[model samples]
Target: MEAEKKVIIVRFSGELSIKPDAEKYQAIERLCKQISLRLSEKNVFIDITHFHDRFQIKVSEQEVQSVCAVLDRSFGVGNYSLVDFQCSSKEEQILRLVPNYQDQFSGAEFRVRVKRSGQHSYSSMDLEKKAGAILGKTAKVNLSFPQKVLHIEVINEEAFLYSEKRKGPGGLPPHKRERALVLMSGGFDSAVAAWMLMKRGVCVDYLFCNMGGKSTERQTLQIAKVLSDLWNPDPIAKFISLDFTDSIEDIKKHSSLTYRQILLKCKMYEAASNVSKILGCYAIVTGEALGQVSSQSLQNLRAIDLSTRVSVLRPCIGMDKQEIIKKAYEIGTGVLSAKVLELCGITQGKAVRKANPSKTDEYLQSLDQSLIEKAIQERTEILLKDVDGKMLQSEYLFVDEISEGYEVIDCRTQKEFSQWHYAGARNLSLRELLANLKSLNKKKKYVLYCSFGTQTPVAAEIMQQSGFQAYAFKGGIGKLRSLQK
Candidate 1:
C-alpha cells in the first residue's frame, strides 16, 4: 500500500486585526467541515501563522489537517508541501535554514527574498550575500525574476522557510464580539463590503432588500446566493441571511423612480433593525463608496440612517472600485464575483447627485407607513454559493418570482433537505437523484447543488444527458444558506 502523504497548508499575506473574530473563527469551522466533505485523505495539515494578530480557535490536529488538505485542492493554495517543519529561534532560522535552502538547489537559477517581522541581526545586504555564498558562485539567477524563489520570514521570535508564496484571505481578520449586518445589494459594492469585513474578523450577517421593479425580480437574490456561496463554502454559515423582501417591496408600491431610492433604503434599515434584534447582531454593514451613487451621498446616507438604531459600517466607504477589486483578487473571490450578472447595473443615473437630507426625509415620509410594515411581514428568502459551488446558509428578501415558474432542486443529503432546502427544490440526495429524476419537468428550468459543489455535478450531468435542461450551482448549500437573512 502507498504511504499516505502528509501536506502542510500555510496562510500568509493578510493584515490581521480583531474585528471579525467570531465570524472568522466560525468561518474556520465552516471551512473545516467543507473540507471534510470533499476528500477521504487523512494527512492534511494547516498552520494559521499569518493570523498572528487575530484570535483564531485552536482546532485539533486531525481537524486542522483536514481543513488544510481540502482547501489546497478546492481553493487553489500556493504551496502544499510534504516536509518536516522545525520551529526555532530567529538566529537559528537564519543560520540553520539559509544553508539548507542552498543545499536543496545547488545549481538551480533562483533569487532569495528575506522578509522580517522585526529587526534582524543580518543587514539587508548581508543576508543576500549569505544566501549567495550558500548557493555558490556557479548559480546564475536574476534577482528581479528567477526560475526558483526562496522566501524567508524573520519574525520577532523565530523564522520560517518556504519555497512558495502563500496566499491568504487578506483584509483585516474577523474579530469576535463585534457584529455587523451587511446591506447586501446584488452589485459590486455590497459584495466588496462583506469581503472587507470578513477579512478584518467581523462576523457579518446580511440584510439584502430589493425594491419592487419591472426588472428581473428574484435575480437579485440569486446574485446574493452567488456571493454567499463564494465566501462561506462551509455548510455551517449561519453567519449571513436575508431579511424580508415584501417589506421593502411594499415601500416601492407606494413610491416611484423619483425618491424611491431614499425611502426604500430607510425602510430597509427599519426591517434590518428587526432582523438585528432577532439575530442579536449589533451594527449594519454596507458597500458604500464615497460619491459612488445618488443614494450613497452623505446627506442621503444620514436620512437612511434615521430608520435604524444600530451603528452602520461601510467597509468600502473609503475604497475605490479598483481597490475593492484588488482585495477581492487577494481573497480569491474575484473570479466568482466577476461572473455575477446583476440587474441593477444599468439603471443608475449618469449625473452625480449629492443627497439632500431634508429631501430624503420628505421622500421617506411620502411612502405609506402601512405599506412599509406589510413589506416587512412579507420577506423573501434565498441561498448563497461559493466558488467551488458550496451553498452558504443565507436568507434573502422574498420575491414573487421564486414561486412563479422555475424549478429549484436541493442536491443536498436527505437530512439536509429535510432540515431546510430552497423553496422549490424538494429534498433529494445524489444517491436517490436518478430514481426521482423522471419526475422533473423537462420543459422547466432547473438548479442542482450539494453542500458545497461536491455532488451537484453528478446530478447535473445526469440531467443534461437525459435531455433535461439543468444548471449546477457553482457553489452549493453554504451559498444558499447565506441568503436566509
Candidate 2:
C-alpha cells in the first residue's frame, strides 16, 4: 500500500491579514513567491493553495517537516501546521480517522477543534462531537486547557487532520518594503539590525566601511552574503564596500581623541548619505543600540548625525545587547559574528561618552571633506551573491615550506597558545592582531596559523593587505603535528 501523503498549512501574521484587501493580496503574492523560490532550492515539489485564511502546501511526507522548517524561519508566517492524513469530508470518514490519533491523547487532556470550508452535510460542531465521543473514552477532554489539541479542516471534498503547529517569524515579507542601505559592521549588533529590517519587509542594501583592513572586509562580506541568501535571497541586492582607511587616518590627525569616535561616525553618515542618494535608498539603517557603547549615546548620535539629510533608522536602538544577540542566534548569524575578528583599535583611549555638538562640528570641519567624498566616489559595488566567491584565495604553506626570515604567528587565544603551540610561533590572538596592526613590520614575510586552519585566512588576508607577504600554514598546527608523526 502507498503511504499517506502530508501537507503543511501556513498562516500569515495577523498584521498582514488586517491590511486593506489590495495590500493583503499583494503581501500574500510576495510571500508566495518567496516560499516557492525557497522550496525550489531544496528540490521539493509542492502544490500551493492560497485559501482565504491560510496557505495549504502539499508535499511528500518525508519532506513535509523540512519544508515546514524553511517556512517557519521565513517572514510573514504567523504559524504553521503539518497535516498528515486527508480523507473524504463526509462525517463517517472523519470519525474513522479520529481513533487513529487516540494514542496521542493517551492519559492527557485533549480538545477537538474543527473548521469547515465548502458545503458539507454536517456542521463543524457535528464532526467535532463525533470525534470527541470516541476520544472521551481514552482521554480526558478539557476544552479550556487541553494538553493536546486535534485540529480538523474540512475543505470541499477533503478533510485534513493535524495535531501540532509551530510558531513562525511573524512579519511582512521582504521586497514589499522600500529599499534602504544598512551600515553593516559584520558584528553581533549590526547584522541583527539588518535582519530586523529585512524581517519587517525592508529590502536592504549593505554599506560597509572597511576601517579594520581586508580581514574586516572579507568577514563583513561573508556575513552580508549569509544575510542576502537566507532572508532576502534577491540577486539584485548590492554590497557597497568603501575603503575608509584614509578617512580614519585623516580623523586621527585632525580630530581630538575625545571626539574622534563621534567624528568618524559622522564621516560614515556623510558617506552613507551620499551613497544612499546615488542608490535611491529611502533611508540608512544601523545596528546601533542606544547607549550600548560610548559612541552610541543619544548625544553622540545626535552630534554625529547633525549634518545628514538622509533618514537614519536604528532598529536595535531600544533593544538590549542580550536581546539582540538572542535574535542574531535565532536568525543564524551569531556564529559568524562571534568568530569575526574585532577591531578594538578604533579608539585611542577613553572615548567621549556624550560628545558636545559644537566640538563635534569643529572636529568635522577641521578634516578635509574631500576625504569622505573621495572614499564614497571610489566605492565599489558588487552583487551580494558574488562577494564571497570573489575573495582572493589565500596561499597555504606546509611545515617544511617554512623558510628563513618567515614569522609564524598563531592566530589562537592566549590560553590555547600557552597550552601547546608549535616551536618559535608567537601568540597573536585574532583580537590582538587588529589592535596592533600598524606596529607589525610590513617588510617582513609572515606565516599565520590557527587550530585546524579555519581562522588563518582572516589573519593572512589582513597581513597581506597591510603590505606584507603572508601565507597560512596548511592544516594549522594539527597538520604540522601529524607530519612529524
Candidate 3:
C-alpha cells in the first residue's frame, strides 16, 4: 500500500570517478551543488545521495522530466534515468514490481539488464534471468538486440528498476580545473571555444575587446550570458569588456600595413594576458584555428603569443570551420553569434603569411602600449547572470534594408554625402545627427548608415536608448547600394 517511490539516477562521468579520493569527493560535492542550483530555478527540490560512481535524486514523479532536462545539459553527468526505488532488495519485493512494467514489454522484444553493487544475496545474472522470465510472459527475449531494455540496479539493501536511460553531456564538472579567460568576440568560434573548455571542467570567464563600440560590447555580453546560464553551473562567471577602438586606431596609424592584422592580434593578446593576470586566470583561451584567418596563421599566432606573458589555449585550433559551427549550434550560441558582424578588418593590404617574431615585436613596440594598458585598466566587469535583455536590446537596432516609410539617414561627412548618397536619404553626419537629436521627429522610424556599417550601430543604439525607433543599415552603404540596384 506504500506509495511508489520515484528517483532519478545520475551517473557521473568516468573522468570524475578516476580522480583521487579527495578530488573526487570535492568534484561530486560541486556537481551536486550545481544540480541543486539548476533545479531550484525551476521550483524543483530534490534530496541527493551519492554512491560510488553515481548519485540518486529523490524527487516526486512530476519533477522527473524537469530534472532530466537539467542532467541532459549539465557537464559531468554521464547519463541519467528515472527509476522506481524500493528500500529493500528482497527478491519478492522486486518480483512484485516486475509485473507493473508488463505494459511496456507487451508487443516488443525485451531483455532485463541488472547491475549490482555492494553485498547482494543474488548474482546480477541470476537477477537478470529472474526478471527476464517475469517480463518474458508478455514479451519475447532477444539477448543480442532488444527493442526494449528493462534495467535493474541492486546496491546493498536497495533496488532500482527502470526502462529508459537518457544520455548526458558527459564531461568533468565545471570549476574543478583552473580558471581561464576566453577572448570572446560574440562570434561562433569564441562561444564554442568557451563551451569546450567548460566541458573539460575549466571555469571560464570572458574578455571582450570591444572594437565596434557599445553595440558590439552589448551583443558579446549577451552571448557570454547564454553560455553561462546554460552550460556553466558556477556562479562566478565574469564578463570583462574593454573598449579597444583607440588601441586599434593606434595600430592602424603607426603599425606596418602588412603587419596590421598580426599587430592587432598581438595587442589583444597583451590586453588579455594582463587581464588574466589580474583575475588569476591560468591561461587565455581563444577561438583561433590555424589558417582560418590571416592573423590566425601558425607563424602569426606564434608571433602574437610573444606579446603576452600568459599562456594561450586554442580549443578550436585544429577543428574545421564547419565543425566549429556545428558545435556552436549544438551549444545554443549559433543563432546569437550569427547576428554578430565581423568588425576586426584591420588588414588594408595583403598580410604577411609568416610573420617574423622580431619585426612583429618591433612594430608592437612602436605603438603606444599605454593605450592597451589604459583600456585594460578601464575595463568593466559584470557577472554573466546579471546581464539582462535591456543590455542586449541593441541587437534589435539593425536593419538590413530600407523599407517603405522608413527615413534613411546617411552618417557620412558633407563631401561624402554630396558625392554619392542613397536616393531620398537625408544626409546627416554623425556629429550633426547627435547635435540635432532633440529636433528630430520621435514618431518616425529612422535608419542610419555609415561608410562600412560599423559606426551607425552605435548611433542607432544611442537613439534606441533615448526612446526612439531606429536601426543601423547592415553592411553599411555598400550593401544598401547593392540592394538599391
Candidate 4:
C-alpha cells in the first residue's frame, strides 16, 4: 500500500586536499542525516566513509551526480559530488529487454550507452561491444541507427540498466563568503546595504561611525541595535562603535567646513581601518548612495579612503535612497530603531566651519577623555544577538548612539511585537492606527512601528503634523527579537 521511496547518493571531491575540520564534516554529515530523516525512503543512504577505502579518494561514477547537488551553494565547502545512483540491477535492466527484441527492430539502429562505475568491474567500451554482439546475433545489426539504445551503469555491488538517464546538477554553484564589515548608521541606505550583504551570506559586522557627532545620543545605539536585531536576531554580527566625533571636529578645525564633510569621512575611514585590523577584518563596508551626498561622491569616497589601505566595499553604491530603504524595510530593520535613527540631525549639527588636518588633529586631541575611554570600553566588551534570540551572530555589540528619553512605542504586528517589542508597547495595527491616534496624548512624542516596520512613518508624519513630536521605530520589532536570541 506504501509508495516507493527515492534516494540521492553523495560523494566528496577535493575534500581530502581541503582537509576540513571534523566540525565541517560533521556539519555536512548532519545535514545529510537530517535530509535522510526528513524523507521516508527505506533505501535512502549515504556513504562518504568510502573516501577512506579508495586508493586515490576518487568518487565512483554512480556517486558523483548527487554529491554535487547537495554541495552546491554550500559555503566553506571545498568540493562535492553526487556519485553513486543505485538503480534496478542488470537482470532487471531494460537494455537486456531490448536485446531480446533485436530481431523485431529492423529499421532504426540504437546503441547502448554504457557508463560503468569507475571502480566497478566493467568498462563502457566493453559493455558497448558486448551489447552489440548480443544484438547482432539476435537480428540484423544496425549499430549506427539503433532505435532501442539503453543506458547501463554499475557501481559497488549494484547495477542499473534503463532506457533513460538521470541528469546531474550542471553549472557552477554560487560562491558566497559569510564575513564583511558594514558601515551601519541609523539611515535607510546603510541599513539596506548591510541587509543586501547579509543576504549574500556575508556575516555582517557593523561599523557605526558617529560622523555626524550624535554618537552621544542614546538614539544612535537604539537604531543600531534595531538594525542588528533584524539581521541577526540573537545578534551574530558584531557592531563596532567608531567615534568620529573627535575626528569630525579635527577635520573642521583643519579644513573648510564644506570640505569638513568630506575629509571627516577620510578620518572615519582611517579609524575604520584601525578597528578592522583589531577585529581581524579587512574590507570596509558602507551604504553610500552614489552621488547622494558630497561624501558619497566617487571623488570624495576615494579622497577620504585614501587615508587607509584597506579595500572599501559599498554594497549599495549604485542604489538610490528609495531602493535602499525598500530593502531595509524588507529585511525588517527599517522602523525598529526609528526613534534612535532620528538623532542624525543632531550629529550633523556638530560639523564645524573648518575641518582641515591641523584643526582635525586638535579636535581629536580635545576629545573628552571620558567619552573616548567609555566608547572603547563599550565596544571592547560588547554583546551581540541575532533575530533568533541566540547569542551568536556576534559577540560584539558596539555602543549604539547614546540618547535622551522618550516613550518608545512599537506599532509592528502583534506576532512581531510579542517576539520582541519594547517592555511597554501598545498593539495597534495600521488599519486601527487612526482610532488609536485619537487616544494618544498630544504631549507625548509618539514613536510608531509595524511588524518589521512598514506603517510607522505614515503614523509618525500624521502625529507630528498634528502638533506631536512623533518618531518611528528604526529597526522595528524584528530587530528586538534578534537580541540575545
Report the number of the highest-lDDT candidate.
Answer: 3
Per residue, candidate 1 scores C-alpha lDDT tens digits across 1-485 of 64333334344223222327774455544433434445432333333333443212233443443343244333312233322333454554565666666666667888877666566666656666676666665566678778777665555665556676434444332334656677666566776787666555466566655543413233334334434444433232233333335544554566445566666667767767776776677888877787777777787787778778888888788888888877654433443345345433322344225556676666666666665455545554333322232232111211112334657777544544665567657766554566777877899877666555543544565577788876666544545655543
lDDT of 3 by residue, 1-485 (tens): 74554788899888888999999999899889989988896678889999988999988775666576678678999888888546478877887888888997897998899888888677889988888888898899999999999888888888888888878898888774579999999999999889999998899989998888887787788778767766774677899998988988888898778999888888888888888888889999999998898888878888999888888999999998999988986776665677688687788779898999999988887899689878977888998666644455546878887899999898865645765678999998765676689999999999998655555666687788788899988765557767888
Ranking by TM-score: 2, 3, 1, 4
Tens digit of per-residue lDDT, candidate 2, span 1-91: 8665677889999899999998898989999888888878656778889998789887877666547656866899999987857888888
TM-score of each: 0.56, 0.79, 0.78, 0.45
Candidate 4 lowest-lDDT run of ten? 393-402
| Selected candidate, larger TM-score, 2 vs 4 | 2
Query: Per-residue lDDT tens digits of candidate 4, residues 1-485?
Result: 53333332333334322445663454445434433332212122444332331111223333333233223323223433222234443533534554544555444466667654546445668767776666666444455775665555555555544443223222211122335666666677766776565444355566776644543323344445555443333234566665555544544455544555655465556666767676666587877777876556655565566567988888888877777766665555554334344322222434443334454445444444344344454553244543221121121211111134555665654544554455556677554565566777877655565544433554565566677766665544435434324
Model 1 lowest lDDT segment of ten:
392-401
lDDT of each: 0.54, 0.79, 0.82, 0.49
Selected candidate, larger lDDT, 2 vs 4? 2
Error of 4 at 223 (Å): 4.0
**How many residue pairs clash (N, CA or C atoms closer than 3 angstroms) in each of the candidate models, in the order given?**
77, 0, 0, 81
